[model samples]
Target chain A: MTTTPLSPTQRTTIGRGRNRMVEDRAELHRLLDDALIAHLGVVVGGHPVVLPVAFAVDLDGPDEDGTLYVHGSVAAGWLRGAADTTVCVTVTELDGLVAARSAFHHSMNYRSAVVIGTARIVEDPVERRHALGLTVDHMIPGRDATLREPTRKELAATAVLAVPLHEASMKARAEGPVDDAEDIEAGVWGGVIPVGRVFGAVVPDADATGPVPADVVRRARAR
Target chain B: MTTTPLSPTQRTTIGRGRNRMVEDRAELHRLLDDALIAHLGVVVGGHPVVLPVAFAVDLDGPDEDGTLYVHGSVAAGWLRGAADTTVCVTVTELDGLVAARSAFHHSMNYRSAVVIGTARIVEDPVERRHALGLTVDHMIPGRDATLREPTRKELAATAVLAVPLHEASMKARAEGPVDDAEDIEAGVWGGVIPVGRVFGAVVPDADATGPVPADVVRRARAR
Candidate 1:
């Protein structure tokens, strides 16, 4: 965790004006874990490309802080488009919309982390398996244990890339709107419209058999 | 609306399995409008740079389709780096997390649109004013009219980029877990966990303001 590769960027520097930036590693991990999806940005033929991809967090290991793993189908043009290129990956959660009296100040109060690093293709067989396990477990806890292991063919169809979570900055603005002093007296609706993701109960399909796993129930209930 | 630039490589056909892709102009505009933020993917120095940016939908004209308008401080490196270059913009809303019997089938149901096009700066005063108005109205209706207009200096400090809504695709997946017929008998808690954005009632600040505007109050309550 002391490695410069894993150190979180300082709030004062990376996240300038927004004084509410989070610099702690735990906070950054929490945001990454809670993120259901990530937008993968990569360069191809001198053009910038962004792709929405599923991701899993590897938070409990020697490499926990060293890097965050992302994987995609080998057929993915996005992955092939950016081999050995540096990328800036970002995750954002729109907490709410801050509605202020003046237009210049109105903004979305959000929690976001921007990670800058080069992506390296994972090569070691052991590491590749670990990455795949983390990827599957990210979507459904306890799934790796319950399902059949991927065959060689399946592994060939996948490609894993590791990006160090260093040079990262997390900034957020959560308070209600900061209205101008004079506009505060202008009689305008100025405050926050709290917006966030809400989870609905698990909807079991009609054809499914067997009991729900404790892990699924736990995560769903926690939400 | 039907211009296709010749590329040495073939036009990437979206996966047949993922063929609900939308190419209609109206559908693309609706998807972009619903999204408050977009991941702007641009290339800088041969690397992929993806940054989260606030954006508004600029309807091209009464007869034209529309364009996505994204603006930022003139000093923002990510924004400024993209001047006159082609960029990829993506807007996504994760509707739910789908859990299936097997890990391979687990997926998420989301609505996302990817726009790949050339970036052009909005420099003309008339178009700049129009873009600014759309930007403000996109965040909060009528607030633009109520606030002080942007002075020349403020306008000079901001840069707006418009990416035409013409060449784009909107792809959405909304089904529950797609478990194998045989695996459906494995008795797993497999279904969809719905998620979405919720807006709360507007909470006016305590600083002694005038009455809330009728339109603002009406919209807040309506939400």
Candidate 2:
């Protein structure tokens, strides 16, 4: 893990709840690795549009800090609009639901990382293939090696966009409810309800298939 | 359960995967209700910014259709930038991870709702209180009723923004992996690993007295 501190640009700086901001680069990487998807924001027709997309991060990438890769169909309008333009990608993992004595203090315990930078449409075929493999492996470790290589036609239909992780910032809340002293004295129940993603039993498709692979089983249980 | 079809304005129209768009208003409402958090996108300094926030929806509240309420501290810069301006709010639930024989066909089964409209800062005291209560109970059902009423000072420190749901659209993909016939003939494993949110046992804070409430237990199990 790199000991480099996350350099938050002016836009990426956390304005509110400064106490929640984390400057550790490793922490940002951990948050991004744990998250399954990211919300990508781009301006379309003078309006900001945000959509969820599966993403994977490359720590030793060619970008300033690293590269965050997100893919979509070439026909996707948002991807086309985001090309060579500034965008914001956010990944959040809600750890728990904090139940406070007062409604105002109710909050969610979460770790979120926001990356702001220009999105470049990757043109190099070699890098595109590498990013695709990273994306697949990031979702299911070791599963990428088992899959067949993408055909030329399949590559033609996909669009991969890379955003530099130079201006990333992470914020997290991991504590119990912070309630007023008066409310605590009032004897109201207050605590945290832990929340996490659970992977259920894998169901094979109707098509002919062999036994589920060890990698898939491990991924299911690892969660 | 309004029978009204989701009116997709010119901008709300799904451009890439039109078949995935759902026109039923009830489907949009259901997607919003099932999601605990939303990624709110707003343009700041000519760049798009996206952040996750806890949100609640009102099915019959004032607006062309209904209202989506998100609360934050009054000092939040994003809340101030979003006020009286067009913003995009997206709620996405990743249902399952679609694992295919080929990495090209690998995808995720998800339900997502996107709402784009002007955000009006809530001013009316009664409406603000109602929205605050909804935000609280939406996180943990029956939670607001158990907690004491918010003090005047607490309400003054909060900022609630409402976005109308008139321009909302929902999209969902809920099927097994769609793979090429050749991959199936290759005898490769392909299926969907179901994913969902799991809530763990509620841990009471040190200051908390008395037994955990029944509502909290029910909420934990209901998840």
Where does model 2 exceed 4 Å of error?
A1-4, B1-3
Clashing pairs in 1: A187-B210, A209-B187, A210-B187, B60-B66
* DockQ of candidate 1 compared with the true complex: 0.55
Which residue window of length 10 is worst by lDDT in model 2 chain B? B1-10
Instruction: Give the Å shift of residue A187 in candidate 1.
Output: 3.6
Q: Go through the candidates in order and give each one's C-alpha lDDT.
A: 0.69, 0.88
Over B1-223, each residue of candidate 1 has an lDDT whose tens digit, in order, gives 3333212122223543455565455656666666778998887666666777788876643213467788777766667677788898889988777877765666788888777777877787667666777777776666678777766776776678888755566678888887766677655557777776667666666663667666456445542
B34 Cα displacement, candidate 1 (Å): 1.9
lDDT of 2 by residue, A1-223 (tens): 2445664577777888988989988888888888889999999999999999988888888887889999888999899889999999999999999988899999999999889999999888888888888888888888889999999888888789999988888899999999899889889889999999999999889894678888888888877
Best by TM-score: 2
Score residue B177 of candidate 1 by CA lDDT.
Answer: 84
Per-residue CA lDDT of model 1 for A17-65, tens digit only, reads 5566676766777888778788888876667667777776665433435
For candidate 2, write residues B34-101 as lDDT tens digits: 78999999999999999999998887788868889988889998898888999999999999888888
Question: Would you give me the overall lDDT of model 2?
Answer: 0.88
